[model samples]
Target: MPPFLDREEIAPRQQNPKGYAQWLFTQVMLRVNVPRSMRDSFVLEGSELRVGEDRFDLRLFKRIFLVSIGKASVPMAEHAIQTLGDALPLTGVVVGLGTWAAPPGILSLRGDHPVPGRNSFVAAHELLQLMQTADEDTLVLYLISGGASAMAEAPLDASISSEDLSAFYRRLLHSGLAIGKTNVLRKHFSAIKGGRLALAAGAATRCTVLISDVPPGRLDIVGSGPSLADTSTVEEVRRILAETPLLAPVPEAMARFLEQMPETPKTLPEGRLPSTSLSLLSSDSLIEEAIQLVSTAGYRVIVDNTCDDWDYSDAAKYLVERAREESVASIPLCILSAGEVTVSIKGQAGLGGRNQQWALRVAQLIDGQSNFVAMSVGSDGIDGNSPAAGAVVDGSTWQRALRAGMNPQNALESFNAYPLFEALGDTVDPGPSGNNIRDLRVIFVNKQP
Candidate 1:
């Protein structure tokens, strides 16, 4: 397996508490391999494909259409193709934020992320065209992951330009709304979201293989559930727009579109929806691996997800206090939390993602306190607009930043945590892990002597 965290990159700053924390993080990341997860979750025998407890016979289908989207699209599609080799003729599209040299029968397409652009429109159009080719005898295999909301999007209103769609996504990102709520809005505005993708492939046998990046029990929110039914309604969208002033006063054309928007399909369209859906990995998968590694390292592991979607500062305060209270002289403790936090940008935002922002806040709270380290990292290896995956900080981080002529408070307020962490060599740079299972956080409380 390739090392996700570089020991050399972090060696200069590793010392005592920071060294142990960085070492633990590096160990955990090295084990959280995406291709390994894919391999373990899928197995093929003869003409039968086994995904977890489910099985699909390749011989039963005439043509197999593979639609892979999101950050992990390329890897997931490649693995699926390898697993189903010679069983069926596969033709499909791989839409992703990054580029990949697709196999012979697959079309590799790039799409805009964080916001939709002209490329997103083109990709979505291609997917629609491909879906139209499916019929009663066709089998559609959807390898869906996170980031697909923007990576493949088509406006519900034909009058809405690509620029307006981009603006809509920008508002959603900065609106401080939770991902579920954000996707609710996205589902209503798009043509292929909220089960519309499945709806287009009339009578086809659909199977969805997911790498969930949303919280558990809300798998549909992953990639706005393009192949699954939606439970959210137009009424909820309007209410969200009304309450979230950040998203209010939308463009006139956009406002009109939402006002007249129809609700996403609440029930699956018969014969067109998924016959079987398998979730290959999730936030729990990462957290479970971290728990085992931490336990083996002799620290007592505690899984806490109470602040899954809380604001960055609030989550930092809660997790820090929890770690302090749980710490004891007899045994060290590792508090592991998964899922994402919300960040409402203040103004013209600087370069940082929610994970780095949260890590910075924890740094402030733990300043001068010995033996405590806090880390927040994205599983996909790309955090927001910054290049770093996330960040790691211990008790000494605050003082070190100040000594380095860096202002942590100013950086946090400006959403500029990347530069501060980078200057201190505390940023975790993993560079697109070909995976997305949400964010993972660790609060390590070393035993007091």
Candidate 2:
């Protein structure tokens, strides 16, 4: 266990939202990485590993039906099948772009990510068909991760085309609106997200196991809550689209879907329960592991949760400024934080996420300073709009940036952190961490002179 998030724990904060977002992400990651934590935190059960009946029971259930969707779903599904052998008659589907293969008994459908395509539509239909088996006797295991919304598709009532939906999602991903708002728009366009999955599985009793990447751990947001009920209405989706000017208006098809869609029914089916029993399997589960690793390396650890509602660039600037202002002038501390940050792209599409941008921006601010080192990365390894997880920066970071003809401020403004880090060779390449809570930021200010 790490220290609490406050002065009593990690001292105070200049940017509380950034700390809060990171803390929120850390909590989610911590839960998923530790199996025991899963049992303790949420009523988490799978056909494979049954912690207890209250959470999930392998011994109590008979025929099992599994639907694994999104980037994390395949890995989660793979582990689930391996955990439970013949407990329940298992058959399932996994849809995603990653290498998350299916269990022996489970079927898999890989498709596009951050955008929709023909493959995505086909897979979505297949997933809906798979839910046909949701009956009273069925025990459903729903594995959801980030990017599931695009992978598992059910068009808005007007029937948006795959190309159009893909276009819309791409615009949103690049629009710089936060994931929360993006998801609000997504819920309106899709058939399975925003509690749509729970609605589809309305026929059977369901147990939803989720890996939350969103800041606010709303069950309805994770992979659109495949086994959960949705409260977001078509009108709400319309409002989100209207609110964010960066993103285009709802496509004609989606507008029609929003217009024609009926109010949700009160009672949900077994496949879609009245209220699906969903558990947040993990958010920032690895913070303890990270803390253990960092603490063992001979540095103090500060865990903060003020990660939400802050501009990452500004937050990084404040922390660096404050560290420079300290009387000791330098501190040997590893400021550990977690949370997801949003990047609004103002320039031509730059390749990076909020974490990478934060690292680069911090480097620029500390360009004249000495011995400041930091790394901001997605725990899952894939930050945003890039292949690498996040970024790491030190005093020489800007020097390297100059050598490579990369302007740090320009990159930050353009929202292209990955390219800048690439030029400086400071990328934090961990691939996909498999478990995603949100962002992980490690700032080592004046650790070495």
Candidate 3:
């Protein structure tokens, strides 16, 4: 939204690349920072709260507190406070990547992204203190979005140090395990995840407003479901770890830590208070919005398969082949896809994320062709460890890389696509759009000009 991309510089030769990229960026902006989803899901009237059909009377509680985490935390929390009219006896903390002005009585805590840090540790303690103060007569409202799992953390046991946790966290991220498995593991050791946060509220009435970035039907995994039920068990965590190829050898501390972890409840323990109100503000709806926008742009839109578990190379190859097959379209062909990909970064220290890697691979596959352009983007406006949201490349991209003194094959092999894309001026950076909904990709095969 803040001009992270030089639109004209990245446009393809014979296609309306600038306009399409702009529209996609607008869609990402709506999904991440805009409050339309929040407004539609949360309706406040006096002391009563309505989330879809569910309702809660906040007047029933003597004290009201808020806990917000993840990329969308600030915007969502601000919306809640504004809707609550700033006089609801609210006090709370928001932990997120970007800095934001906190409403009165709320403390804004800076949180690390993609990995938890000392700030996350401190924020976890503060959150515990806040929830520990709540009584049966109190109401705790939690606003959760993607990245909360890393943005806030506290070990359930004393065996693992913060440094150990950080190491393990990095390993899990690089392991190429799907997010659901990653979250299942995250909940096992953390004091605040997998409904532990809700348990800490004692008998307080709890409500949750969720902006889901997890796979569909898994709201319990969103923000690792701090206040919801966790259906995954420790066995699942161990199995996933054993099966997934980790980026580094498992640390001894992690092994010991996992062995010592108490068995996570596969369901709520008897008599535990579930969230009294839960609302989902965003999810696949963003994908649908993107589809409509692309179709409206006059390209013949083709909905591609969800690529959540696909390897970046495999997904890129498949989409490229399909785009090639559709090259005869009278109108331009736009292939759309949504879902995250896994990249096993086994010590490669790449400067790019999965989206860039995927696009880079596609660029290689279509190198000599002149009509195809492919892009993959993280909806949150940041991809992996790189500054770019993603990358876009046309058939000429490989040659462009060569002209810029970059070797595309070497970049892909080293898991270092970011620098190559950067040199070729193909990287797309949309600067922290404050939202997350997995990844979205678009492949355009122009009408054979």
Candidate 4:
């Protein structure tokens, strides 16, 4: 069992499919051990530091700096300090969702997420100031994870107000664009994104350790590639802005700002770029662990990520149909998918997220069926504007909602899934898990009589 899950809360449903699915989720999450992964990936022996196959002699550098950002910032920073503090002179900054009691040599600051605010600007300013301090003799270590884009941001143009920056993010969140495209626009708009952060480090020898939340092989998209080279172009940003109707709500100042905005750095000179980088954890790790847990429990597991960037309703239909076709009456089956799904908020979005919305859609489709349960959840333990991580739904969920005088159709349409799930006691609420890879969806089919 994962340390984060509440066993007592899940005890009552132990005999049901929902309980089994929740248990599997907890087990899979337990495998996302950030500290252990960091320890395994980074090693310090004598004055030499080994990161994977690369080695760096710490004695060559005049000073070492560490920058930790995103949801996993606290744990990642904590381990780095514990491991490297005694051996090297370390000073750094951490920007995350909440306040933390930072170590003696570190500065801890909080920033807003899912949107940028004044605090985000402050954090960005501090990070930029620190990065500017590094020179040829400095070695900078960056610990980046999901949510960093919103946690620390500064508009590339100084004239862009914080309100306009927040509006840009808010529009992007509801735009239904894929994560990659969303970040492309973000990189163009920010001074700290793309390869600009590396540029700020000057000629420092930099190393980055990432906990990736983007799709497979898109490591650069994680935290908008603050230290890595950017592959996207300004033309791509223009195309996205022109094509996305959801971005219509963006402030007019944003348009004016973009018109004069210079392209983000596409290539960094020698020494300005990271010397080595490692993806310490990702959705692949989460899915791999989930497959093992289900297989060990005697279920035939099928893995598919085809629905990754699809709209919530569309993904629900595709996965549910696939589950029905693949399920066998003689043996239990579990279908797993890991990656985020897109949601286009039409008007005022109610209190829910893509995970809850998708699960609710699946509930409607499987309504009169038996022995089927579908669970969708975010690894971070918070889903969109809702307090729940996501939600779980079985074949009977529709009828249960109806008996309680709730309209599933109305709830899904208005993006108000949290209240519906909460009323049914099916919302997956684990609080913040202090980790993020991406979202996970599980479809379980029990053996038929």
Which order, best to worst by lDDT? Answer: 4, 1, 3, 2
Model 1 poorest ten-residue lDDT run: 5-14
Candidate 2 wrong stretches, greater than 4 Å? 1-62, 99-104, 260-281, 322-331
Instruction: Provide the lowest-lDDT 10-residue window in model 2.
Output: 3-12
The TM-scores of all predictions, comma-separated, are 0.95, 0.82, 0.92, 0.96
Q: Judged by lDDT, which candidate is best?
A: 4
lDDT of 3 at 351: 88
* Candidates sorted on TM-score, descending: 4, 1, 3, 2
lDDT of 4: 0.87
What local lDDT score does residue 371 receive in model 2, on the 0 to 100 scale? 59
Writing each residue's lDDT as its tens digit, candidate 4 over 1-449 gives: 23464443442232677887887778777777787788887888888888877888887887889999999998888888887857767889899988899978898999889899888899999999999998888889899999999999998887878888888898889989989999999998889999788889988998988999899898778999998888988789888888998887467777887776787777775553348888899999988999888888888999999999999999999999999999988888899999999999988989999999999999999997878899999999899999998999998999999999999899999999999999999998888887889999999888753
Cα lDDT computed for each candidate against the true fold? 0.86, 0.64, 0.78, 0.87
RMSD of each: 2.3, 6.8, 2.8, 2.0
> Considering summed lDDT, which 10 consecutive residues are worst modelled in model 3?
4-13
Using TM-score as the measure, name the better of candidate 2 and candidate 3: 3
What's model 1's lDDT at 247?
78
Model 3, residue 88: distance off in Å is 2.8
Error of 4 at 36 (Å): 1.7
